[model samples]
Every structure is written in structure tokens, then in C-alpha cells.
Target: MSLLPDSAVTSAPGLRRAQLLLARQALEAILAAQRPADAILQDLFRDNRQCGSRDRARISELVYGVLRDLRRLQAIAGVQADAGALCALRLLDQGLADAATLEAWGLTASTALARRLAGFDPATLTPAQRDNLPQACHERLVAQYGEDATAALAQALRGQAQVDLRVNRLKATREAARQRLAQEGVKAEPTPRSPLGLRLSARAPLQNLASFREGWVEPQDEGSQLIALLVGARPGDTVVDYCAGAGGKTLALAAQMQDRGELLACDISAARLKKLRPRLQRAGVNSVVGLALPDETALAKFAGRCDAVLVDAPCSATGTWRRNPELRLREPDFAALQALQLRILGDAARLPRAGGRLVYATCSLMAVENDEVVRAFLEQHPEYVREDAGEILRAAGADWQEPELRLLPQRHGTDGFYAVAFRRQGE
Candidate 1:
């Protein structure tokens, strides 16, 4: 029984105002607090259990819309931009609100706000400003990908990400899943890069769909689907999904193995892993053995035994900015994150046996966390040799053909992902 305010708020206009007020409260709390955006929303909705679906969606959109375009809205509205001002700028920019409506939303009217955004052109602003990217990170991208591509990525990431899903091969084929969605009056198309990936053109209440509830499909980005495919786990093989948060790739790998392999999903946080349990059951996956580590017993149980180990190491999550712009609000300590990546890499490498594969992956666009980490790891461990990541993908029939696997959001229509593989040569 939820007590969240329902949509019965007087009239349509009043409903909008109520939702906007909720959004403002949520935004302020999210910005000031260190907790993740999703957690804040969960708590907010839990307390306001009577908030209807429409109210929830509207409130969420306002919160995310402002967070995504936070910098641009602040610039347009000047330094005095609060949630009201930011919301007004966004609504006006999207043509959802006029000056009067902006005032109605509790934003003070200013000629500067109107003038700055009138007939706005992205090309007029500098690349970083235009793309709304952090300047230091933008500079790093410029150094690696050059100015043009970096700008393109920023623009691409600023757009709303398309909904992508992985057709669970264990329960349904891609063709069958597509047919099911079509039967339900949902439009979907196969993703370009991943054979198992489906792209949804419009948002649908997926949880209500029989296909999703039956685990015929699981929502996953094409980039993430590709990473799971790249793991290349086979039946009867011992595989490790190191740092498996929520076990998205774990479920995919279990299906890849036809549920016949020893698949250990390892993570430092048991709570995150706990959430993976029901999803695994829904997907009918039975092969994955969850192991929370730095537990010496668990580490010893799997040490030097895995045929393939996926070090999906923690990162800045720069690649996922399209869906999660809240990342831009805070700066993670790169030095500390890098040190942790190194330690995790060393620990994960210990799980792969001689001649086994080590696939290091991150959903990050930064060269510091992507290539630099791999470079440092290789220098420290001479026994391990770099494997041709692109060739491995090609062998699996992916169209990627570079020396390493670096999929850019702008070019690949997928989140920016970096993956490099290594093999311990003993065979």
C-alpha cells in the first residue's frame, strides 16, 4: 500500500505543478547529497507512494532533463539558476513551455534567458561548451580522438539513448523475441552490431510485457551486449565475471555456455550481487555461482582456474553519459580510481589459468582509464601477452576490425566502450 500523491490533483495544470515541485525537491536533494540519483528517486517515490505512473514519469523526466543539460541551462539562465530556473529553461528550450508558463513554473523572467537561447545554434559555442562536456575530460578526448570526434561524441552522448534489449538465447531467439514484441504492438529492430540485440524505437512499459516478464528479453545496451558476446564463454568452461554488478553479463554468459559451465559472478558488494539473484532466476540461469570477495576462502576456491575472466573494472562511466548524465555532477578521484583498477586487475588476472583469456573492459571514453590502465598492467606482468581484441570479435563474426575494441557512441551508435584482451602464454 503506497501513499504517494496520486494524479487527482485538481486539474491538468495543477498536476503539472505538483510534479514539477516534486522534481525540484528531488533535484536539490540529489545535487546536495552524495547518494546516487536512482537511490534518491527510489526513496522519494517510496515516501510518496500514491504518486501515479504519469506523475512519476513526469517528475523523473524533469529531474533527469535538468541533470543532463545542467551546465547549458545554468549558462542560459545565468549563475542564479536554481531548479525552477533550470526547469523553465529546459521546458522552454523543448517548446513545452512559454514565458508565461515559465513564470507559472516559478522562474523569474529575464530578457537574457530568452535572448541567449533564441535561435540557439550548437556550432556557435566552443566544442566543450556545445557538447556540455567537462573541459578537462574534453581536452583528453581531443588529445586522443582529436577535436572533431570528441565534439561528435559529446553531441551524441547528449541525446536520449535508444532502448536496446538482449534476446535471451536460453529462452528465446532474436527472431522469436522480435515477433513477440511485434505481436504486442511494439516496434523493434535488430541492432546493427550485436546479433542478439534489439532496438526499440519508442518507450514501452516493458515490465508489463509477457516476453520481458518471462525472461525472453532483458534490457541491455548494444555495447553491453557486445561485451557479453566478447567474453566468448563456452560450455563446460570455467568463467569468471569479475566485478559483476547486478550480473547483466553474468546472465548473458550463462546462456552463452548453455548453462553447462562453472560461472562465478564475483563482486565486492554483496548488496549489488543480491539484486542479481531474482534476475538470474527470471532468466532461468542456474550455472552462475555468486562469490563475494576479498573473502580469502572464495578467492582461493577460484584462483588460477578460470578459462576466461572478464575484468569489467569500475570506471568513470563516461560512456554511459547518454542515459546517466548525473555522472557529470561529481568528479571521481581519477588517481584513486586508477589505483583501484590496477589492484582489481592484478586480483582478477589471478583467476585465469595459464593460456586462458583475460578480457579487460570498461564503459569509459577516457584514455587514462582505458588504454593507460592496460598499458600499465602489461608492463607489470611480462608473462601475459596482449591478444588482438578486434580479431577475437571478428572471429565471433562482429564487424569490428581495429587492433583493439573501442566503440564510440558517435560512430558505433552504442555507448563508448573500451576492451582489450590478454592471454597468459603457457601452451
Candidate 2:
């Protein structure tokens, strides 16, 4: 599993240079591939086993810092700045490095670059660059949320995300899980909203913890936990997670149903569905049936039979920018994404029986992918009536009260999420 050979692992003397070098390489790969920074760095660290804890800490900070404020760094460093240059600029801005440090890393700090970085003004930045968003994404946000709201959302997205966990009710109560995690030196407090959620004060090696290993808790966003709660699936009901990639929501739904319902987890990718098997076993869930789609005849059999259906459709993931900053650099094709979302909603709509509930949700802030998609679906399927998501969630103990539930990182301290529930008109 190690990516690097034995020769590359260095002792303490060259550790600083090694860390910088690794950070540069990792950042370059992330920028070029436009992949998740977390995944890319996991691969990089795996290859270089010689990297100590400190080395990994430094590397991750540099890589994520550069990505979090990339456009501004690009403005000061250069539009085509290399990873090394960006890293140097980031260090300089944070007061983590100086001229000598850059020189030691074989990098140059021009007077202009230094001046611009030190005296950088928000007034000087273009709206897009100020928001750290690609031009297309900026324009889209402005069109959907207006300039002022978009800027606030952008500011929220630039901040870091806290780790949240959803206690597996099947395995333990929230208080019991908290106590067990604390015994293992992990500090967490109950989340403000979701009854089953906990917010960790800092990241810990949760995978090695007995609580996680035994599935007493699973990492999930509070907003995501709220979405599962909104589904309102009960024991003995038949529910379907229509686009269940890796079964996060499916698992949560099973817990909601008290592991006594018929829960169908369906996804187009069999490989993705395969991942849910181990998770299901670990969570001690027995009600789930994983299905890989394109089995039209098979899925059709469930039509008008399920009590509830959840369409956590794929989207541009703009609401998740706080955790996945790399997405800010890429331009998503909104037209195509909209069309696909609408189509998926239509397909999922058929699964809920008459008078059954359907909740369409996305981790997206864009109207085209959130409200627009749902409204479009309503226009096509008049038999489905939109319900107040806030009312449903409030009865379940959430503070929200809007017609459609929109969770924003800035306002709610959670990932940006949108959910709208609907009920079939006839019984």
C-alpha cells in the first residue's frame, strides 16, 4: 500500500524539506486532477510512509490552505502559479515562512508578489476571486441567490467544517456513545439540531476507536442526519433510498425504521452498492436490500408499493464547499446536471405509493439543482403535493420552520442542504 520506496523515507534533519516537497506534489496533483484534496493526500501519504505525524500535519495544512483561498493566491503569485509558488505565498500570508524559507525551498519572492500579498485588499479582488469561486460558479450563485446572499454563502464555504457523527440507535444511545468516545479521549457534544447527532471538538483517529469499530457511531453531517429524520420512516414501512451511494442515508433510514422495515438501497453503480455491505453488517442493520439499477423490470416491481422514497440526487455539491474546496476551482455544467436531476426525480417519484411520502434532497445551494428541479418535477407530476419540510422536521425536534428546509454552513453551522418533501395526492 506504500506508494514510495524505502529510500524516500527520511529522518528528522530533512523532514521539513520533505514535508514541503510532499505538499507541493500533492497540491499540484489536486489542482491538475481537480479531485478531492483529502483523497489525493491520503494516496500521497500512503506512498510515503516515512512521513511522520508532523510531516502529514504540515503537508495537509499547506495543501488545504492553498485550496481554500486559491484565487486570491493566484492573483498575487500569478495566474499560472505553480504549486511551490502558491505554497510559499500561503506560508508568507500566514506568517509561517519568510524570504529565507522560500529561498531554501528553491523559490523566489519578488518584491511585487510580497507587496501584493501583504497589502492585499478585498476591494482589489474581482467578485469571483473575492468569493474564491470560478467565474461561472460565481455568476450562477449570483443569479440564484443574488449578490449579497451569494457573498455570505461564499464566505461560509471558505471556512473549515467540523466533524459530526450520527449515533447508530441500533447499537447505542447518543449519551452512551458520547461516554464511550470520551473514554477513548474523543470529545464531542450533542449537536444543536438533530437529536441523534454529535459535534466533535477536534478530529481524532476515529477509525481506531472502539466506538467506531463497533459501529456505535458513524460520521455524518448534522444536516444529513436531519434529512434522514425528515423522511419519517417508521417500523414495518417499506422505504426506498433511490440513489443510495454507499448507503449513508439508507443506514440512517434503517435506524429510523427501528430495523423492522423493508429498506431498498438502489444505485446505478454496483461497485458503490457493494461498499454498503460491510457497513450494513457493522451497523447491525438487517432490513436493507441493496440493488444495483438498470434492472428496470426489477425496480418497476416496487412501484406504488413503498411508503416512502428518498431521492438524494447527485448535484454540483456547491453547498459542501466548506469541506470540499477543490470544487470551487472547477466549472460544473448546470444545464446537463439540471436535466439529469429532473429525470432522476421523475424516476424516484414512481416508487412511492398513493398517499406515500417522497423527500427530494441535495447537498447543493444552487436553485437550478435544488428548488428549480423540484418545482420542475411538480409541474410534470401534479399528483405530488409539496409539503412543509420544516414542519415535519420541527415535529421531530428541529428548529427550522420554512416551507423548504435549507441548511447553510454560515447560519446553521452545518453543510448546505436543501430538502423538500411531497406526498402523493391520492390513496
TM-score of each: 0.91, 0.93
Residues 76-119 of candidate 2: C-alpha lDDT, one tens digit per residue: 87664889888878877776666565665566653345676878
How far is each candidate from the true structure, as Cα RMSD in Å? Answer: 3.2, 3.4
lDDT for each residue of candidate 1 in 120-218, tens digit (9 for 90 to 100): 665655666666777777778899988877777888888888899998989998999999999988899999878888999899999899999999999
Provide the global lDDT of candidate 2 against the true structure.
0.87
* Highest TM-score model number: 2
lDDT at position 50, candidate 1 = 73
List where candidate 1 sits over 4 angstroms from the true fold: 1-15, 108-127
Rate residue 268 of model 1 by lDDT.
87
The parts of candidate 2 lying over 4 Å away from their true place are: 1-15, 109-112, 119-122
| Residue 243 alpha-carbon offset, candidate 2, angstroms | 1.0
Q: How displaced is residue 202 in candidate 2, in Å?
A: 1.3
